[model samples]
Target: MLCLTAQSALQGRSDRSAWQYTRADTPGTGSVRWLAVTDHFHGEQVLRIHVVAGPDSPSPGFPLPRAGEVVASPAMQRLFASTPDDQLDDRFPGEVTGTIPVDLLSHPEQLIAVVGGEVPGMFTAAGIATSPDHAFFAFARIIVGIAALVLLVPVAVFVVMASRIAAAQRERRLAALRLVGATRSQTAAIAAVESGIAALAGTFAGWLAYEGLRRVLASSVTYEGFPFHAADVRAPLAALVLVPLLAVLVSVFPLRRNASKLPTAVRALPLAVGIGGLFLVTYTSAAGFDELAALFVISTVVGALVVGPWVCLQVGRLLARARSATTALAARRIEHDPKASFRAASALVFAAFAATYLSGLVSAYGDLPGTGIPPGVVTVFDGRDREIVSDGTMADEERIRTREAIASPNAIINTRREFVLRERRLWDDVESAVHFAVTIVVVVAGCGVAAGAAGGVLERRRSFALLRASGTTLGQLRRVVVLETGVPLVAMTGLGVALGVLTLVATKGPLPTPGFAAVVASGLAVALLVAATPLAVLERASGIDAIRPGTSA
Candidate 1:
């Protein structure tokens, strides 16, 4: 969906650009000299008056809806229609009443650039239109394309979790059928049918949900300019078809169930190398973060992924030596199946990595109040217009002309308050984007945690029954679950935070550090919530019926 939305936005932008450029090349037949935009005096209110010097005959360019050959505001039309000729400006350009082609208004900046005319200082409409893709549409595509890649990680995590959960259930059912002399193909066919039905249903449901949410958003939300029509927010047909196929494949061919109970300590090697790379970049007078540095930065997170299971195994060993029986029991369980113990934490590792890195990024670059004409702000166009600054105002140059256009001092500028506005807006946008992305990742982690919790109980039902049948109480069992799972969850969260902060310091400077308290608190808050999810299914898992000797259910 994220990729689809990005595709939609990019396609919409392309269509608009092509249409605008096409109209620009149309060689419209209009003869009108645009005079200075004159402000009209209608009592107290300031009305926009677009006065053009042209004859009342049919104008050459796209004519307005009314019988005039010019494009002026309705107020101009009213004034021209009702006011006496003597009352108006003695040199009023001809009396014209018409609307400009909507396309002309849409590309104010592009048109202004082409027109080579004076830009009124009062309007910021074109100023906000930064023409992000005018020269770098490919760059825009890459940036948005990166979003698809980033989001795919979470979606992949979710699918892996779902498949792992399904695999556990399939193992029991299929193993039983095999024991009863069922052929391998028969079991595979049955598995395929089950997966196919569920995948189809789920895919359809997801599509419905996406469509409903998009419609609601389209109706309620509005854009500042270049309104992106809701119709453009469509997923490609290929994406729609791919979803079900991927889901079915994931469900039917999950990771192998018989994972060898071997300690995966070697997984930590990459983590060491990644950190070493960080050190090399940080201390070796390395210039900018090169591709090598980037690889190192990424190595830290990827290394953490496989290392988590090993960490769990070691944590289990240490817990086994603890004085508390609950801890010992939990530790033993984790030692028995460390991969299972770390499954959910895998999801969270990604979240933690993102949280810490993003936090560092925001702290480091979120604020860049310029260092220019005003001495504290970034300069606009190399600060050549220092003479324009007087008493903290752009008032010196009422008409500031640059290569771009003859813009007025009142226009949305790169100096003074406008710069301040941009700085503030940048901070806000970065903060919001980070918040949204983090929230999404956290939610994805939550899904994994929830599924892992439920799957854990179901897989270990017989053990839960045995424990309960013995002298072990449900309370102790709960403690064991929390200790075993919660330990790894906390450790993974802390590891993620540590690695994130360290990487941040290495890549970005350390002057503006990430807020340790907030980041830690938030990560722990989410970790604790995930850790508690297992307790929700404890009672049902340890039921009396699960104690039956031959029952796999």
Candidate 2:
């Protein structure tokens, strides 16, 4: 990268002549101003100028233009000649007039080293290089700011989800200890201990993911002139400690609530928590206040614990609604069971996350804008007298008559190549910026689906018992789920694909045809995964006798 930068500088110097001359119109010197001039390009229509002095007077302010300092350009000089007190517009076009070129100007000064390419300097530079650094910094700040803001959603989701999981597992572990003749204190201790262990495990898993991503980023394409700092180990360690601490904090109320409930209430714990959470999520999303929203968000997450049971119930209802001969049997089995449906559909959230994230990623990449650089033109910086060797690649429709002696073929080809490179980078950056957002969306979606399945299972437990009594075979039970799920999966698949395509319109952006197709396909895959839950639920709920009142699995 450094070599390339230096090469570009040297190339610039070869084409442009540098010159240095004292201002003839300084207050103590002669009356004539010594202005610098250079040709605009290969054409003679324009000239660039750098003001070397004011006409026989000192500039008005402190830190004013120095005696030998280059002041303004041709357009600026023309504007300033009349106002004298007027500020110059920074965008003034380049011009050439009096002083010698850079090469000749640097003859007496050893500070200016002659590189094989263009040297980066104010007067000798052109376009963006000649512009102020603050402008570039401002633009970068905006991009970084947007990226950071978008990432917050996922962070919140993770925190909420993790807290719910930790709390639910802690309660179950505590209950098991109580059943074994453990004291209340012993049960609470077990809950805390189990929670701590789980938190530690979760922290480790998060750290691994962070480390993996860091390595991938480090090993991925390096941003040529940019810097990237790797994450600190201490930070990940802190996160591990923090996650568990937070889990303990979030579980306090729930733990208290659970301990006070009767055994019957404990069995309903998952469903109650999930329903409350669902209400909370809905409320928060609707409320639009920070505090209220936070509470709602927390509730929604707690609701996830009940997701497994609820989803089962919903699935049964959906199956029954479809009204096929086998539907009632499938619905009954799923609704009446708790553990059976829970096991099969426990991973619903994971599937949802995969689907949502995949869709977001695909959409982001597909909508990425292309580099629109045209071909066959060279932009030159003719400062002082001579030309800069670092000529810009041309745009399309501009004819280039390349010298046979030149090593590279023509400006047209280079223009096209650079265009492709820029376009690729644009897409990569956009997708990367939105990665965390996509992850969060997927996780949230998955959690919702999982909670729904859980609820469905709990509600349908009685139905499953009835089906068993009716002699519904396990194979038949499984088949019912397949048919039941197949319809919704197909519908969802269609929805996802339609939504993926509609994203272009929603975002008011579209990419090439191939990119669009890729995005739609990913959406379809996600839909199919979401649709497969019923089939899995069937497998777990197949043996319905356990759901019957007189039986135990």
Candidate 3:
């Protein structure tokens, strides 16, 4: 979905003409100003900025009038405020002289309207490229691409967690069939039927949900100061068709006959070495092997994931040695199935990893270099000057070859307001993308924890009832549950944070900054709350009937 959105943004951008004019907005209510621009185009007083499909819709509508002919709408005119007195300059709106090729002064007629000081918030199809909005499509594309990468962590976590839960559930059922003289092929067929039903049902529901999701994104998310078309947000047809097939493969592939796997400790050695290699590369100057470093990062992530189950196994064994019955009971259960024990924490662990690493990178980059310029001030420059960005500032458009730009040869050194505004918008979009990514990880993780906890409750009912029948208190049973899942969540999530901070410091050459620390801390607190979802089902799980032995649940 994210890749498709990015592609759609680029496709839309390919049709845009270079900006011909630019204007500074009033001090506040930027949404109103942008909306005013939207309305002006909608009224056909100016040409359509985006060509919408329909045989009847007018093509090449009215051209926006020049300064002398434009009748300013009072509401739209208020969207422009003159440059402030403190930062005022010769190129200040309504005061700028003969045209220059770059932003704000590129369009003569619109510049005249701005210079004359009764600015209408109107834009020609070409003039729309003049404002900070011109780069919004590119910004949106980058944001979605980053979001996809960030979100992959949570998706991978969920897949691993869900597979653990499903495996545990199926093993007991399939083990019974093995005792009944069921052939291997018969068992495989049975497993396929069970998993197939679930896959088909889930795929159908996902298809339904995607339609609503597409509508919501189309309505609420904007690029280039306008929302994208609803049709552009769809998943590929191939993806929709393949989802159930993939789900079946994930569920059925693990049902192998005579499958023998190495002990997790032995399996963990290579992963650990990969992580060690990451730390070694960090301390050494192996920067050119960034691709190898990326592989190391993957190793680190997978190692952290594997560590959760290993921790559960060790803790269970240690607890099983305890004198207290409750401790032994909790510990033995985790020991019996360590992967299932650690499943609930996987999402949260991934969240911590992502938050710590991504926030560290974001903090290191900081705001755009010239983002500090005053709101109304726009530094001028000669369009042809090759040294426009020689002072370490970002260039607006180095390839611009407009006639006005060619006529002007002088370069001014101050920061341009348009670039400042564009960078700010870019930052705003990034912040929104981060929030969206965090929410996705949290929601997916929350569901995992909730399902894992509920499944644990169901699976342990008989044991809980047996303990209670033998004088165990309800409080003690709850403690057992909490210690089993809760401790691993804290311990494993901490490991994730440790790994994340190490990766960030090693790769970026700085410790996680204070700003990133706060962000990661806040994210961890929210993710930790998912650990409590199991408490909601505790009351029903310890019923007395489960204590009556020899009868199946």
Better of 1 and 2 by TM-score: 1
Taking all chains together, each candidate's TM-score versus the true structure is 0.70, 0.43, 0.60
Candidate 1, superposed: residue stretches over 4 Å from native? 2-4, 17-135, 166-169, 175-183, 215-232, 237-239, 254-256, 286-295, 365-386, 390-416, 508-534
Q: Please report the TM-score between candidate 3 and the true structure.
A: 0.60
What tens-digit string does per-residue lDDT give for candidate 3 at 468-504? 7788888888777766666566566676677787777
User: How do the residues 274-337 of candidate 2 rate in per-residue lDDT, one tens digit apiece?
Assistant: 3344444444454644345455334433443344454445555676776666777556655555
Clashing pairs in 1: 29-60, 29-61, 30-60, 30-61, 121-410, 121-411, 370-377, 370-378, 371-377, 371-378
Error of 1 at 149 (Å): 2.8
Please tell me which model should have the higher lDDT, number 2 or number 3. 3
- As a TM-score, model 1 comes out at 0.70
Worst 10 residues of 1 by lDDT: 122-131
Q: Evaluate model 3: give its lDDT.
A: 0.51
RMSD of 1: 8.0
Query: How do the residues 331-406 of candidate 1 rate in per-residue lDDT, one tens digit apiece?
Result: 8888888887777666557666665676666565545553333422223342344334334433222223221122
